[model samples]
Target: MSNNDIKFIHWFRSASPYIRVHKGKTFVIHMDDSVIGSDNFTGLVHDLALLNSLEIRLVLVFSTRHSIESRLNDHADVSHYHNGIRITDSETMEVIKDAAGKLRVEIEAALSVGLGNTPMLNAKVIISSGNYVRAKPMGVVDGVDYLYTGTVRSIETETINKQLDANEIVLIPPLGYSITGDVFNLQATALTRDVATKLGADKIIYLSSVDGISDQSGKLIKEMIVTEAEKYLLENKIPDAAEQQLLSHAVYACKKGIDRVHVINSSLDGGLIQELFSRDGVGTMISSTSFDELRQATVDDISGILELIVPLEKSGVLVERSREKLELEIENFTVMLRDDVIIGCGALYLYEKEMTAEVACLVIHGDYKNSGRGEQIYSVLEQRARENSIDSIFVLTTQAEHWFRELGFDEISVDELPVEKKELYNFKRNSKIFIKKLN
Candidate 1:
């Protein structure tokens, strides 16, 4: 096979886990009017259709900001605002309604496209839109009458879920209806958050012009917890107004129990698929909790641990461990979990009488072996040893002796090992011993 074909097969296999994880889960995607005219908009639509084919329920909340601005400019009207929110007067509300309606139809058409040799060829997608969201006017604030600008009051979550249950992609425009027969302009960022929260969606994705959130150095921040997202917003670190608003709402969504919120550049081809399927996504991910957790392993983590170590055991790099043995020593194991997948693990077998512990089964998934994660796990085990009043730790390795030495362990003879460990050592393996003395 050609190199490209091999790469495709590898990527497809790698993405299988994510595919299984996302199936049947709800995701709310937000797109502004700006994306409609972008060169890669069709590519974005293709990715959406692909996701739909993967059995992921999708909800699209789209805004009309650019369209509204164009309409107002055409009519020689200027927009008014209060606290960064558009003040939708009678005329402005008319423009908003027209823009929102036009954009909704455009988006629906884009999603429905199917042609020969196109990604959406033979792809059938049903788009649903309605008065599933209710709103109330923002009313007067600081003695300024905000006529039609509004906030989401409630969402028809049950009805929306019913449509999703039927395998339809629910399309929501950035306009809400009121009880008094009124159409109100809504802020799309807050609207997306509210929709995801109400639906209990698994993810909220913002397709923006920016690639993702960045730090002061202009480096793209791959991930952040909710608190970190809030801090970035509070510090006014995000220079783009659109990104700032998305981050603010992302924090709100996380606080409301949504697990993950992604912000990716809409112009990038296949960006949605790349962000959702890849292990290291190409965009920013703000999560409710730490995405990578280092902690003591429980019995529940046995299967993941086995998936990591079983290959190494076959290669003779590490000793083989039985399921029952791991379960009995589960408390002694510390694992590095990324999105709940164990990527690295190590075990500390304590010997109280010897005032030392044996660090064993040090293994890292091959994909992440060079990322310094192994060192982090080893450090945690060393700290664990210190906490238990152990003066030193030892590791026996047939292949990783140099790695242990770099961590400050010195080469040691097997006779230097504790009596019990020496007695249990496998003569056939003949692994080198290394010990680190904790200060």
Candidate 2:
């Protein structure tokens, strides 16, 4: 894989539950201009690169509104409120064109670079607005006609899908035209959500200028299920305006069967990769209640297993074990597999005592790292320990101290080990002792 592909895989492993759930399926990426400045944008690019490398079918959609230059020239007095509401008058409609037009060109330019200069510029970028969106005017809600602003009446899903199938990235400007040929300015957020819902996208990621959804304490809310996000919104737990938008998008995505949605900062370097590839990501992920399982390793699983471990072993992040050793001990191992391939694996060693055992050789395949596969394997091993009447389990690892610490394993001096274990420890290469009590 290329560097961008590796970065993308890392990000996917971190933030997306669909990585495990939606194997061999197509993905549609919806990004807007605001995403251009965030660290998450780089990760988004990384994910796109990865999908390309893996030969996964992907549809990348870039949405934008008009440019500030056009808007200013058209409506000299129009301005936007802090809440993202535009203060518009009759003249505002004239300037809306400039803003939306300039923004679209800028977005296309960015995407061209993001796609690795892959000829996306010359490639067909279906840019049009007409019956593509059926909208009704947001007519005078209280005493205002709400001139030029409209809500979606319907989206032409078939047309969008046809272009998506042709691998043409759809670029939707916030300007939409009615069948009667009247031009109306639309909110980018509203348009994006409508398009995503209409298309039934697999994932909808919102890249924002802020640090993502946060609790009252200002710490980033890393992951949340749909129910938890609703409660947070209802209770006013989210602290900022940016977070509120993210929560709203997340809830909308979940309700619309988008499967998963991510709200992350766009300014941080590798922000997207951290969210997609690592377990403790830098943003919030909202999804449904889908828990994956760990299974027994099979003979056909060796290649993927090797791909995961070889790099780590070469860099000494994992112990160097021969393929023969792995094949022989394959029966002693349990793996977290998705789509008939192993994403994670670990070994269980049975000791003589009825209530004691050792869990060792834990490894998460490189591409699958940080997706909680390691934790799943550990949970399974703990259950197996109970089944075998093992009261406690221990592990020795040179690295991954923090990982084991987070899982409730406390460090113990080597002197506390059983005589045989201590002897084994002495002969073993790199080691740190971790013990977990099972009752």
Candidate 3:
């Protein structure tokens, strides 16, 4: 087979797990009006159609900021705002309705394409849109009347759910209707977060201009949980109000019961699919448990610990360890868990008199081995050793010598081990010893 063909097979296999996991899951995607105007918008539509074909329930929430602003620029009146919210007067409300309606139709046409020139070839996507969201007036916040600007009051989930179950993509505009028969302009981010929360969606994805939140050094902050995200805003001043607002909504969503929120650069080709299918996604992921912890193992984790290591033991990569021995030495182990499931683990066996520790059993789950979980487990054990006043860390391995060497470990003689450990070393296994000196 050709090399390119082989690579395709490998990538397809790698993507299979994500496809299985995401099928039948509900995801709310927020698209900025800026993205709609980009050259890559057609590609984004194709990707969304692929998601539809894969049986993913989709709720598309679209923002009209750029669209409405473009329309307002044609008239003589300047746009007015209070606290970053557009003050939608009678004329501005007319512009809002026209722009929203125009974008909705264009999007629907894009989703309905089946001319065989695109990925939608012969596939039909049914989409629904309407008054599924109700709103109430902002009631003059800070004494500035938000005339036609409103906040979400209640979501009509049953109707949306019914449409979703019927395999129809639900399209939501950034507007809501009230009981008094008036259309109100809505903040797209707030509407998206609220709808996802009310529907108990599995994810909220924002297709944005920026890749994601970045640190002062311009490195992408790939993952942040609710608490950490809140701290970042306080510690680092984000000069861009748009980015700050987007991240604020992400944190709010995580706190309000949504576990996953993704912000990706929609301008990148296939970015939406890349974020969903890849192990290390192409954008920022604000999760509820981004730093899901490493804690000292307890008696309860014995079974999970064994489950993680037994395969390695069977493959002769690790020396056999027994349940009784593990139970007795459980205090030396630390486990990494995500959503309460053990994903990685390592142990720190301290040599008190020698002021050293042996880092052992750094096992990560089979599917997640290369995603830095093992490295994280190793770091946690190293910190544990330092806290215990150990000046060096060591490991004995039959299969992971190169892996350790890459992480700053140096091959060392077995005789260089702490006296007690040297005496108990299993000579028959002929394991290699590697050591790292702590600073």
Candidate 4:
């Protein structure tokens, strides 16, 4: 496809549950050491690069509690999972250097090459170990002595912000230090949370192996709030440790005033794009409540509404309502506009003391279909009905039965129509009768 097509797709995917956009916002991505060799890494880098192209500031911190040498000595058997965190033993720690350091360099090189090729990639990307992290070693708990594990004591927020302001991506290795000059291994997820909180980032996204957040039937949960997530977690239905971490981070981000958080599967092609731009995102979105209102259609909105319904009218899916008719009833029309662009429009025709009004000409732009705009327009008409003290609303649609059904409209027989409407119905084009009760 062309560049414009790609951009349109990008915008569509931005509203998806799996894709998230922190436009003019700061974000921190915790890249677990295990993700280094995973198939998802290349796509992850590309997605991050795409974000950079959009001028959204971000930081990527790689964390590994085990050194590469340890993994090699252990014959690469040091398994890592759960919230993208790797469990490390003494043998694992010995080989972690191979994964964390050497592997980091390779990843950095790959990102550099990729960025260099893209005209949009101009941000400075810095790669460093936990050299700047002030850490405290973990203490023994229960019957297990946590080997080289350490938690973040402090992150140099000033340094991070300075880099971010300069349009740089900061990459941190999972190595931390104490005031006494002791270095320790750290969990990638823990460090990511600490740094993101410290930086007051807009979001913190975790790309995992599983398909985003799922319901009891394993279907993805599209949108949710922290309270809902907390309830889900309390019921022990979140399913896995990774999901638990995603929920924890989402709650933390919400509590800290971060706009939103997302957890998605990295393996899916274009998963990031699907999550960030599409209305029904691929993964789950934990966000604050959103309330939408409809306003009076403006003069500038006429052309857009006409364009939206023109195709349907041509195909006989909708009746051909002339622009002259629209101009006359302009005051009775309501429109849904996003960024001043009309995505949907509908009209209300009043009758004197009839206790009902006709809700006609509902149309949503093709690109914005399935975005609930039609329902929003219908809601506006219902509110108008209440204002006018009308008890019910009527519609005549040749198609769109399911759409009307979703709005609580019922299929009423032609005989149910009032005398005046029935007379008009007989003289006018063929259409199905639909009625919605306001009371």
Candidate 5:
């Protein structure tokens, strides 16, 4: 009925795939005190409620770093850290317990809101929190006694899983207990990693102060595999301490068999939903495998390839290709896939006798055309041509002449076409011929 309505409909439709896949999958989310106290906290809670409604099992692990600092400062007590970990003495431990308890209650209250005419209306989200984590003290290291600072020794997975099975969100505070009736402070990042790994969660997400992981040039990296993330950490490429910590644990979680880890700015409203429900999320994702893949197409990809190109074909921007033809020529195609959907594709037809190749059916999905996906597909095709020892490559285009020209292709006469292609050329199309020579 309106532009906004249309956009909303499109977005909802686009998110349907993610929604389907995320259903019944467990996601472990880690948030620091910064997120709990942020202005968008309520909105984030609402999004999480929506996820629960969609049948996604949620495990929320929260830290109270800022809260503890505020309490310590109020009491005129100084905090200590060794190797970036807070050393919690008797007094600071009391502050941590107070902060964590208060914050957990605040989060629970926020999640329980369901006022009329509000986002949470009719959304009754149940939350569960308990001594689900068991801890062992870090003990003494390097001749320093680190009392009360601990690591996760084991998790009460059966109890947590029972809560999840009942469709309740499991809220884990950054505090663990020992067999001797002692409480210990735990790092939220490490807790998130251990929880997700132990529970075999589908994803581990960090809602943090920073936007996401970025390269040294300050460009946001949308996706990276475990190895690349480790390289970044090893070289100290990530500048933000928060992001560095998250990345370090993200690498660990992925290596430990968690399929995906996402880090997004908690201050950004609706970021949780966007990161979960969109094709290209608003944050960096670390996975054990590539999230988006560009590789040679197989016969199975003919359907996705045709879905991408049929619109162009109908618009007369390219010639029509039947499914039968696509199946036969699928081996000649390279496709760019996002979540296993072909978003961009091109085919290279080599004329080995003439030492040339034809780049054909270059198409990018309408949603991704502006994001340089076309160039990525073209680069792959060019590489393929070189690998095959082609002296030059060409394209016949009724449109996109300017694009080819920008890629260093010069206009050529149809008469210069390879003898075999010249005979098969469509004179009715009157397409321009562009060729790029490799030397």
Candidate 6:
């Protein structure tokens, strides 16, 4: 009915695929104590409830850092840390337990919300917590005993799985109890990574304090592989405690066989939903798989490239060219592939005399049309054109006019094209010309 409504419909339809992919998959999400106290806590709770309603099995892990600090402050004790870990003496363990117990109740209460005319309205979300984690004392190290500070010994996967199968969201706290009747303060990030690895979770997400992991310039990284994450952690001096913990544990989780680990800022309303449901999620994703592989197209890629564009050619949206012509121009093309499949491709034909390049034959597989592949291919060609001292880039298209226009291209008459290209222009095709200034 309206532009906004149409956009919403498109977004909703696009989200359905992700929803389907998430269905029945187990995800372990971790949040720090500050998340429970944030202004957007209620909204975060609603997102968790929505995920449950979507039939996604969830395991939520949380820490009581700020709350524990508050308790320690009130009890007249100064906190101590060894190698970035809190030295949890018996006295500190009391503050941890008190803070964690209160938080567990608050989290459960928040998730139990049921109201009218709201996202949580009519949403029935069941929460379950347990001693699902077994831990042992982090004994003396370097002559400094981490008394009452525990490391995860093992995770009760079967019990956690049973609760998840029963449609219950498992909320695990950072404190763990030993068989010897001792409650120990556990490092939340360590526990989250251990639990996710043990359960073989489909995904593990950390709701961070920062707006995901950012570079020195404060730009958030969209995705990275485990190796790249390791290098990043070594390179970036992240200032936020929560952000550092999320990154360190994300690298650990991905290396330990967890395929995906996401980090998003919990302060944003509905941030979790945006992180999970959207492509190029509103967070940094540390993944096991390489996101894409872009390289120059060779003769071997001819068949794959042809298959990629045959449909568009048949539909008269693309100008059909013979195999011999493609062979001659193969060196001008670049392809972005995933898992060895040529998902997208484009060609850059340079007119040296005019210092202009023609970008043509751009096509992304139907499934990947809206997945940013086309823009990626364009960027590659644009960069290549710049490297060759090209002054401008142009495209002639019977379709995708609006797509190019949206990316800062200006509609231009064909007469402005390079003289050589002008001579070859096909009036029968009547393709619209669009030009992008490179300088």
Instruction: State each model's CA lDDT, in order.
Output: 0.89, 0.66, 0.87, 0.70, 0.89, 0.86
Error of 5 at 110 (Å): 1.3
lDDT of 2 by residue, 294-330 (tens): 7777766666577667777898767777889888877
Task: List model 1 lDDT by residue over 1-439, tens digit each.
Answer: 9999999998996687678678999999998679896888888888899899889999999988888888888889898988789999998988888888888889899988989798788888899999998999989999987889999999999999999998899999988899998998999878999999999999999987789988778899999999999999888898877678788899999999999999998888888898998888889999999777899999988988887888899999989999999999999999998765678899999999999999999888887878888899999999999999999999999888788888999999989999999998999999999999997
TM-score between candidate 4 and the true structure:
0.63
TM-score of each: 0.83, 0.61, 0.73, 0.63, 0.75, 0.70
CA lDDT, candidate 4, residue 417: 79
Tell me how far candidate 1 lies from the true structure as C-alpha RMSD in angstroms: 3.8
Error of 6 at 267 (Å): 0.7
Candidate 5 Cα outliers beyond 4 Å, as residue runs: 215-219, 294-336, 340-363, 366-439
* Whole-model lDDT, model 3: 0.87
Clash pairs, candidate 6, are none
Model 1 TM-score (2 dp): 0.83
Q: Write the per-residue lDDT of candidate 6 for residues 216-279, one digit (tens) a residue.
A: 6777888889888888778766655657767889888888888888888878787898878765
Candidate 6 segments whose C-alpha is farther than 4 A from its true place: 235-242, 293-439
| Candidate RMSDs in order | 3.8, 7.7, 7.0, 7.0, 5.1, 9.3
Worst 10 residues of 2 by lDDT: 121-130
| RMSD to native, candidate 6 | 9.3
Alpha carbon lDDT of residue 390, candidate 2? 82
- Measured with C-alpha atoms, the lDDT of residue 306 in candidate 6 is 87
Per-residue accuracy of model 4 over 175-228 as CA lDDT, tens digit each = 777898666678766677777778888777766656768767777887777788
